[model samples]
Target: MTTVSILPISDANGERIYRAIAPDKQSTGRTAGEALDALTAQLEGDEFNALLLI
Candidate 1:
């Protein structure tokens, strides 16, 4: 399984955001779940397959 890192951050205006970082990609969302979902989508299909071969 691939490992991802989720970090909570604040914008210049102090709005909360979540950032999800994978091996070679990153995504952000309003919440942690949203961030993870975005990252998952990015990792699906060809990208996911490539990771498995590594």
Candidate 2:
């Protein structure tokens, strides 16, 4: 299993932040969903897999 921790935010529900530890031993600690959403608008990408989301 992987480990993930969403960065603390002023309003969690308002913004979605997630951390994903990939199988390659690389980890991302903080990422904004809204930011990704915006990126998704310009580019194409796949879904993210996270061990724990909170």
Best prediction by lDDT: 1
Candidate 2: residue 52 Cα off by (Å) = 14
Q: Which stretches of candidate 1 lie over 4 Å from their true place?
A: 46-54
lDDT of each: 0.77, 0.40
Per residue, candidate 2 scores C-alpha lDDT tens digits across 1-54 of 434333444435565444333333322224555433343343324433445454
Q: What is the TM-score of each candidate against the true structure?
A: 0.74, 0.25
Which candidate leads in TM-score? 1
**Model 1 CA lDDT for position 10:** 94
Clashes of each: 0, 0
